[model samples]
Target: MDTQQNTALTRALAEVPGPLPTSGVIHITLPHTDRFTVVGNHLAQHPDLSCTAVGLAVRIQSLPQGAKVGIKALAARCKEGEKRIAAALRELEAHGYLRRVRDRLPSGRIITRTVFCNRPAALLHPRRPAEAPPQPAKPEPAPAPAPVPMQRPAPAPVCHPTAAPPAPEVPVAPVAPPALSAPLFVPRVPPPTAPKAPRRPLPQPGELTPELDRAATTFLSDLHRHAPQFTLSEDDVRRLVPGVAAWLERAVRPDSIRRTLTDDPPQPLKHPAKLLAHRLTELLPPVPPGVDALAALDRPRPRFTVTPFQTCEDCDRAFRSPTPGHCRDCRETRAAYAQAAA
Candidate 1:
């Protein structure tokens, strides 16, 4: 046997005790309970529980109570991705092998705890239909009243008159309208052509220096080479050229920008323009001293002048000299006899 088997055998032999009454001997036992066995069988034969979910449930059961479990930790332990672990955990929860409760602590903080129950759903949570409220008693209808008898009125007398004879009428013949000699022919007119839309003017190259233009072009070319799936339009180029120029103004080399863009971007880029714009903005260096100073000079500054004297706190009136609390007019008028003596 190999070294491992020999070591295990030696340990087993050493652990075997002699025939004597033992005291304070600790015995470890496996779960062999009927409930555990039933749970295992149910997990094995479960229709909705997948193999991964079963494995996750088993792992959760093996762990100690209140163990810290998370998606990343479980993924690393099971040698799988986080998404697969999450999906398996969700499946276990859906199949009644797990239950999650969101509880709030006294500190007003919310936390979610997952509870694993190996027992069947029937024992864990017995289904009891909600009891409906009693309906109100129906009201009694009123009885119908008796019908009344009908009454007839008296008839009036009629007057008789002689009938008049009808007169005879003469018949006339109908006249027909004259028919056209020939049918008129009309020519079909052609539809008018729509006016062509005016083209947008290209950005002036003179706005950017030769070196800046060259750097922008190089950056664009490298971007296309790295991510050929992204197609750059004229508007995109116009929007991005100023950012590139700003980088060049800050003394950032074009090659460095290209390297940063080509570095392992996320696969299946959904919005390349937005991604590129974000990267360019994030990696942009600080403005140079000369540019910052020039900008500071161009910005308008607020002006403030110091006053000659302090204003009174009560009346907010200015004085020639400083006063602690009140102005001269208010100090002369007080609720004391000192003002009367003055």
Candidate 2:
């Protein structure tokens, strides 16, 4: 009895070690409930991709449509440098997992659109998925035997003097024809390439007036206090001053410019400098010519004729005003706002 008990204990201890793999992986995965991304083995386990590229591919696949996957954006999120991230992206493009197309807007703005494929092989060859291990075939049951009709005893043969043998009958084909189905297809339209626009350099440091330079510098510096994401380094501030100067030179009020920039900012802004650059360029107002441009810069910008919805600071009441500030009653003690140029 003691020997039997010892034998059982030894067998159980040995079995515990047997279940453990000598090499390879052990997974403890759970069903994803939310905030999960589906990645295919093609991208996840590519033989050619480096560890960084494979990781980036997984991250890209998991991202929702329209999400930014640029090298700079990815570098910001991951520990990799911009050059490293850029190289990884190139590797992915070469392997057919990623495609970047430069597209142009009617407004003459160019944007690079990135397309990601979870399974590149399946896209190139539709039947490639058939290479997966086939499932075990289920056993088919034997068909039931056809029932036999009972044989009627033959009637006694009647003999006729002039009976003619029946003419040979021809075999007829089956009535129904085989069904045919059309093959499935997925159509992909390539984005149209836009002609490259000539690059325009920003106004040089020497061209901007000292006053305009000061205002532009202060404007960028103040953004950090109100909107932390807009914080700029000294070099970035210097680099971007020319953009802000362009706005100031056009008779734009510092207040309005600040409001325009700070309003409805993107969440988790990756590159504030780039964001400012785009807004400064695309939102640039038409440049008024010569004497009129100089005259416009001398005075406060004209107010809108139509009163828009506004919330007052003093009373916190919603009211219609051409600009943001205290309502009429709250601002009665202060000087009246400028009316439209007449």
Candidate 3:
């Protein structure tokens, strides 16, 4: 009856989704030794050990005795950040569950070895015997020596010499004083000064010469033909003349500027002057140093070949080949027709 009851309990446990389902599979069962039990029960509940710290400890224990461990490798294996793993290792060291010994080899190399412990270090090894107090060294006695005798010298006699007589002194004449004169007058000279250079007059607004006026008129006329809505007044032309002159100075053709402004603006422009100024500054062609210097010599000249005109099939109007069979207006009309049909 006991054997039958054991078989029935095993059958029920096999149906559960856990390790018991694969009990026959190859496994290394760790013995419930004192160190293992203490690590699972006591270290897991340690106040200083966080969940991450406990998990790291378990991972370290599962490894072989002398296997290498690094913060990066451990973090990758545990799917945690390096900083968190480092913090966990530091906590383990602080709580005595880990020890890191650093030593230098004779080759002048330093290395660190990490030792994982299931229990505190004090429990693993016996306390070292207390060291004895140091005592002072004894002094040695001095030895005696023999004494020596003293000696004396003799005295000398005194002598006398003959004396000489003194002579009389002679009289001298008195000296006279010289007369003083008045001081001489002198003139002071001033330093030479440099002449001031004349300043050139600043160009006034709308101050265009005949040639510049003609160029400005032609540019304005081309711009007006392309975008009739963007009309420039006399003052506007005056404000924009410098930018147009800059383009001309760079040897940019007026036709190129006109085509650029007209050919399919990226978006519907509300301000033409600002766009023109930006284009004139950014897209201005390079100017050679002298009239004899060709631009093509420095760099290849950009090809701007005009596309062959194609007649629209629907509107019967000549248009560029970008739309192929239909012009812009016809394409919009067809789109509207399709929308209506839909």
Candidate 4:
């Protein structure tokens, strides 16, 4: 595997806590079940773990009884990183799947390594099971013999005369053939498309007089707020009244123009003038003035600063730091824990 994937696998394996062995015993978890979950999930994503793990298991199996294998060498042979292999071994140890052995070689040098050869048959499931032996058949007993019978000679027979034969009967007439059925014709139906509904009448241009225009604009603003689903376009406005677009331009200075032609207004301003501003900024030709123009200038860069913090897991509390890092509760808890463990 690549370095990154190997690192991830290593980290995942390290998350497991257990021991590895050499023969007759398979690595496994003890009372705790969570370790199994982490290992199982890790293996699920990278099946290579199985191959590498099994390879290490096999290598350990090959070693002389009680002989430990170097973690580095095992990892190299398995084409996995040392860290990942260590994680797997750690997980195994944590789960009580395997036991770690530390010793000095005959050279009087210290040996710090792991041996993962085998596990208890109960813990390690065989990938391929051994075939069962053929069963022998049972023999049947012999049957008893039967008794034979004898036959006797025949006596003399008498003869009889024959009578005249009757005339042959006439042949029966054949029945008529069955009537034919008529061919059926089914009408073909076309696939369904959009439904056809009556169209609503467009609002009249004369309807948008100065006074009515104010009312429609106010009503539309209220409608937009309460019923956001319903949106009125510039065409809807211009169609309702003549010169409404021009009136809007004078009433409110929109960012850019939309080349929409309407019956009432020769030139129609676009709906969502802000959206028009963004589009104008992107167009090849120079965009209109206002927000878009101001945005064209280069601005100052933004800076971000983060305050330091400390956390106390024993108390499950967090606090912002005024000076340097220090959590009194965490330190006290760790000290107590160390003393207790010692």
State TM-scores per candidate. Answer: 0.31, 0.32, 0.27, 0.19
Worst 10 residues of 2 by lDDT: 182-191
How well is each residue in 108-157 modelled by candidate 1, as lDDT tens digits?
99999877777644443434557999999998888778778668676686
For candidate 3, list the clashing residue pairs, or say none: none
Lowest lDDT 10-residue stretch of candidate 4: 182-191
Candidate 4 local Cα displacement, residue 122, angstroms = 5.9
TM-score of 4: 0.19
lDDT of 3 by residue, 1-342 (tens): 999999977776666664653456544344575544335577777765799999888889878767767898897687889999999988877776777778899999998978776766345354456899998887876766655655645546656566556656666666554333321111122224656655323222244467766796678756776677556666666677766765555566788867765566546677776666556556656554774465547777698978889999987899888546888899899999999999
CA lDDT, every model vs. true structure: 0.68, 0.78, 0.68, 0.49
The candidate scoring highest on TM-score is 2
For candidate 3, which ten residues in a row score worst on lDDT?
182-191
**Candidate 2 residue pairs that clash:** none
Candidate 2: give its CA RMSD in angstroms: 21.3
lDDT of 4: 0.49
**How many Å off is the CA of 87 in candidate 3?**
1.5
What order do candidates take by TM-score, descending? 2, 1, 3, 4
Residue runs of model 4 more than 4 Å from their true location after superposition: 1-51, 66-68, 102-117, 121-342
